[model samples]
Target: MKPGIRPAHRPVVFRDKAADLASPTRSTMTGDRTVTWEDGTTYPMADVEISSASHPFHTGTARVLDTVGRVERFERRYGRGEAR
Candidate 1:
């Protein structure tokens, strides 16, 4: 815990453009740009390509379908038998 040796943790606004979500958190990252948040307060903002709001794993929006179930459905529709 050396004084002035560690990076400073300050308020940062992480913006997820794809999800249109912005949240405030403390980080060592700094930004020259600022943005007015929903509360009408401006903070050092950083643009993120992906965040929990837009991330498939976090949002549970990942396209994960059951391939076996799909094949079964298709076979049932066309009659399950030897392929011709």
Candidate 2:
């Protein structure tokens, strides 16, 4: 490792706005806001839009797109033939 070239890494808190969840994790992300965890330790809080709490996969609410039906419709309208 080179000195003075590498950026400093520290612990930061990531807060998911959608899920209204917060967790302490080691990350290089920095934020102006700060929060104290349950242990009474303060760290930088970064607000995020998505997390496992709100994600479809983790919540078992994932939606599947109907691509097969769309393809069939397109083929019926335009015909599946090679164009020169």
The best candidate by lDDT is 2
Clash totals for all candidate models: 0, 0
Candidate 1 clash pair list: none
lDDT values of the candidates? 0.90, 0.93
The predictions' CA RMSDs to the true structure, in order, are 6.7, 1.6
Model 2 lDDT per residue over 1-84, tens place:
777987678999999999999989998788999999899999999999999999999999999999999999999999998978
**Clash pairs, model 2 backbone:** none
* Decoy 2 TM-score against native: 0.88
Error of 1 at 17 (Å): 1.2
- In model 2, state the lDDT of residue 30: 88
Query: Candidate 1 local accuracy as lDDT?
Result: 0.90
Cα lDDT for residue 6, candidate 1: 91
